[model samples]
Target: MSVDTAAIRRIAKLARIHVEEEALPGLAAEFNGILQWIEQLQQVDTSGVEPMAGGGATALRWRADEVTDGAQAERVLANAPEREGEYFSVPKVVE
Candidate 1:
């Protein structure tokens, strides 16, 4: 399948991409190459293939569900030039 200049212009307008008149031919050629690749992929035979949820069938490993404050308050506040007790102090900008 070949993409014409008009179709390229319409695709560019829909995607909000700026395609100049000189660059439209090159862009259309690239789009035609992509469509040709898709056409070739459509010719592949997959009669007995089983579709999985994702690319692989490996189960995801999960850690224990625990919630905490991350235990790095002092380490995190060490880089603050101005801090108040355990938090960074910022200058009042709004009344």
Candidate 2:
């Protein structure tokens, strides 16, 4: 597929990008090459292939879901600019 200067200009206008007249031909050719590559990709056959989350063969490692105390409240609040008791104090936004 071929893309002309006019089409390139229209695309540039739609994308809100400014393209100079001298650079329109190069942009058009680049767009045409990208479209050609997409067209080529359409010819590949993958009827029986299963879609994969990643390219690797190993399954995702997972840990047991259990609730546990974080045990670092005072240490975490130590860096707070304003704190009350064991919590960071922030300006109230609502009544």
* Candidate with maximal TM-score: 1
lDDT of residue 30 for candidate 1: 91
Clashes of 2: 0
Per-candidate clashes, comma-separated:
0, 0
What RMSD does each model have against the real structure? 3.6, 5.2
Model 1, 1-95: lDDT tens digits are 78999999999999999889999999989999999999999999977876665555767889989998789999999999999999999999999
Q: Write one digit per residue (lDDT tens) for candidate 2, span 1-95.
A: 78999999998999999999999999988999999999999999978887677755858899999886578988888899999898889999999
The C-alpha lDDT values of all candidates are 0.90, 0.90
